[model samples]
Target: MSVRQTPLTCHGHTRPVVHLAFSGITDKGYYVMSACKDGKPMLRYGDTGDWIGTFEGHKGAVWGVALNYDGTRAATGAADFSAKIWDARSGHEEHAFQHNHIVKSVAFNPQGNLLVTGSNEKIIRIFDLQRPDAEPAKMMGHESNLRHCEFYTENIIVSCSDDKTIRLWDVTSAQEIRKLEFPNIVSDIEVSTQNRLLTLTHGNTVAFWNLDNLSLIKEFEVPTQIHSASLKPDKSIFVCGGEDFKLYKYDFDTGIELEAFKGHFGPVHCVRFSPDAELYASGSEDGTLRLWQTTVGKNYGLWKCVQAPSDLDKPGDAEG
Candidate 1:
C-alpha cells in the first residue's frame, strides 16, 4: 500500500495569493516570498514554511514578488502603479519605481543589480539598482496587459501577455528580439537557467522550449486548465495546479500523469519548485500556500518519518 502524502499548509494572507517565488540557497538557507491581494507581501523560511516577515508599504494588491539570488533583497509589483524593492533582512522599503499604470510583474537579474517590471501599460522597464534615481530603459511592443516577465539572461528579457504572445527583448538595445504567438493567453512562464529550459502554461497545454534557441522541445496536454507549472531542478518531472483545485504531477520525459490530488479549496494561481527541488509550493485563491514533497515517504526538511517497531529493528535502521 502507498502512504498518503500530506502537505504543509501555510496561512496568513487574508486575500488570494497571486504569486510565489523562491530564492537560491544562501548562507541562511533559501527563502520563499509571496504576493497577495491583501496589499501585503510575505517572506518565509523555504524549507519549514515558517513566517519570517511581511513587507507592508504597498497601498494596493501586490501582483508579483521576487527574491534576489542570495535572498538579501525582494521586489514587488502592485496595483498601486509602483514596484518597490525591500531589504529582505530588515523588511524596510529601499526604493519605489513609479509607473503610469498598475505593475503586474517584477524580477531581479542574477547579479541583483537590476530589476525588470511589466505593467498594465503593456511596457517593460529595466531599473538599475546601482542608480535608483536614473531613468529606466523602456521596451514596448505587447498589444495588451503584461501577465509575466523575467530575465532570460543579464542582457535578455522574456515577457508573456494577455495578447496571446510571448516576446523577447534585448536590454542594451531596447529592441525586440523575437516573438512567439499562441492561441491562448499565456498564464505562467518559468525560465530555468540551470536546466536551460523554459516552461510555459496556457489554456490546457504545457510547453517546454530550449532556453538557448527558443525552439520548441515538447508539449503536453493536461486534463484541466492549468494556471501554473514548474519543472523539477533535474528536469525529470514536473508539477502544476489549476482551476480544478487539484495539484498534478507528471513524468517529464514521457508526459505521463504520475499523480493528481486535491488540496486547495479554490483555484490555484501559482506553483514553483524550491531551489533545492525537494518540494514544490503552490498558492491559491483560498488564501493559503502549501508545500508538497516531490518524493513521498522521504525524510526531508520538516517532513519526517516515524518508523514502526518492526522497521526500527531492521538491519539498516540504525544507519538511517
Candidate 2:
C-alpha cells in the first residue's frame, strides 16, 4: 500500500473552490480545472499540480466548471447568469451563452458535441457545439433551480435540484423521462448508467439507487453534510466530503468507513475521481484543491494540494 503524500502546492483564488473536474486522461494527464466564488477559473497540471493559467471572464462567481473527455474545451457556469465556453488550454472565450438567471451547473455530453446548462430560471438548455448560433433544445420541468446535472449517456441526463427530486431527461426528445423523489434537496449526483444513480443528500448521507426499479441499494451513513461525492467505475468504493472539512471513503459492500482524509480547514465543496479511478480530487472553501490516492479495500491517506497565486486578489486564494 502507498501512503498519500503532499508533493506540491499552488495558490491563487481568494474564494473557496466550489467545483473541480479532470479531463479523461490516464498516463501523463494534463489539466485539472477549478472554479471559485471569486469569479475566476483555473487550470493546473494533474501530476505536478502546477498552475497553468486563470480563466478570467465571468463577472460574478463561477458556479461550475466542466471539461470534455478529450480536455480540449471547458464550460463554465457563473452567478453572472451565463455559461461560457473557453479553450481548455488557452483560457480563451469561445462563446457566451446567456440565460435568464444565474447559471448553477453545466455539463458536457460524452461525445463533447452537446453542452448543457441549468439555471435558477428553472430551465435546462442543451446546445450543439457544431452550431453555436442554433437555438438550444430546452427541457423545463422543475419549478425550482436545477442544481446539478450528470449525463449518463447520449440519450439520458440526470439532474437534481432544490425541489428535492432527481429528474431524468431524454436528450433526443428534450423531454423529462422520470422524476425520482428524495427526502432532501439534492446536493450532487453521479451516474454509471441509466440504471444506477449516486446521490449525495443535502445533509450528511450518501445513497445509491438502482434506477431500474427506483429502489435504494445502499444508504451509506456519513457524519457531515455532504458537499460532494464521487463514484468509481465499478461503483463499489466511493467518497464524500462535507462541512467538517473531511473526505470520507467507504466500501459499498459493507458501508463502513474505509478512510478519512483531512487537510482542508474549510468546507469541501466538490470531489471527483480520475478517469482511471486510481486518483481522486477535491475542491474546498479553503480556496484550495486536494488530490488523493485510492484503493479498493485498503486505506490510502490524503494527498491534498493548494495552488499558486493570481495578480488579482480573491477570497479563497490566501495560503491557508
Candidate 3:
C-alpha cells in the first residue's frame, strides 16, 4: 500500500517566498520562518501551517530569514541594504544593521550571540548581537553575489555564492580556509544536524559534501532544476522542490526518487525539514507555504493495522 499525504497551505504573503528556515525544536514547539518579496518575514508553527506572527519593517523584499537555537530571536536580510534582528516572542525589532548592498543570506552562530549575513557585495559579515553599533568582522572573496551561509562549527562558517563555489572561513581571523568549486552555479546550501552539507546547483543537480573536510561526497541529478533541498536528520531521505511545482522525495543512500507530489501552484523556492523530524515546510513562488508529513500518511510505530482480503477476488472465479 502507498500513502499519499495531503499538504496544508498557509496563506498571507503577497509576494513570492524566497527562503524558509526551521528553528531548533524546544519543549514548547518549533517555529518556521519565511522570507518573501513582500518585504515581510513571517513566523509560524513548524508542524502545522498555522500563523504565529509577522515581522514587519523592511521596506524592500526580504531575501533571507533565520532563527536562533531557541527560536526567541530572528534575523532577516533584505533588499533595503540591511539586516534586522527581532525579538520573536514580541515580534518587535531589536536592531538593524546597515549594509553596502542588498543582504542576501543571514544565519546565527550556535551560541546565538553572533549573526552572519552575506550580501550582493560579495562579502560575509559577522555581527556581535551584544554590540550592534560595533563594526562587523568581514570576509571577502566571492566573485559574485553570496547566496547562503551557515555555521559549520563554533569557529568556522560555510558559504555558497553564485560564482560556482563554496568557501569555508575561520570566524576569528576572518580568513578563507578552503574552497570547493562546482561546475554549475550554486543556488542554495543546507547543513544537516549530522554535519553534512547539501547544495542545489543550477544544473539540475544536488550535491553533498563532508562538512569537516569540505570534500565531495555524493551528487544526484534531478529531472528539474531544484532551488532548494534538505536532508533528514537521520540521513534516510531527502526532500526537494523546484521548477516542477512538485515536491520530490529521494532515498538518501541510493538517490532514487521515492515519491513525488504536487503541493504548490507555482515553483517551490525552498524546503526544510522540521527539527523534530515530524514534518517539512515548503515556500513557493505562489506566495504561500505548505506543510507535509515526513512519512506521508503511515505511522512508523511498532504496530500497524493490516487489512484482510475480500472473498470477491480470492479465487479464480469465472465472470458472470
**Clash count, one per candidate:** 0, 13, 0
Best by lDDT: 1
TM-score of structure candidate 3: 0.91
Candidate 1 lDDT tens digits, 19-61: 9999999888999998999999989999878888989899999
Q: What's the C-alpha lDDT at position 21 in model 1? A: 97
Give me the overall lDDT of model 2.
0.79
User: Which residue ranges in model 1 land beyond 4 Å of their true spot?
Assistant: 306-320
- Give candidate 1's error at residue 294 in angstroms: 0.6
Best by TM-score: 1
Tens digit per residue, CA lDDT, model 3, 120-150: 9999999999998999999999999999988
State the local distance difference test value for candidate 3. 0.85
Model 2: CA > 4 A from native: 1-9, 26-30, 194-196, 295-320
Q: Write the per-residue lDDT of candidate 2 for residues 1-320, one digit (tens) a residue.
A: 22342312346779889988888783557568888999998887764456788898899999999988778899999999899999976889999999889998999999999998899988989999899889999999998998888788888888888999888899999899888777788898776653366555667778887765567777876888897888787777888898898988888789889888787879889888777676678888888887666752233222333233331222132222
Better of 2 and 3 by lDDT: 3
- The reply for model 3, stretches above 4 Å from the true place, is 196-200, 298-320
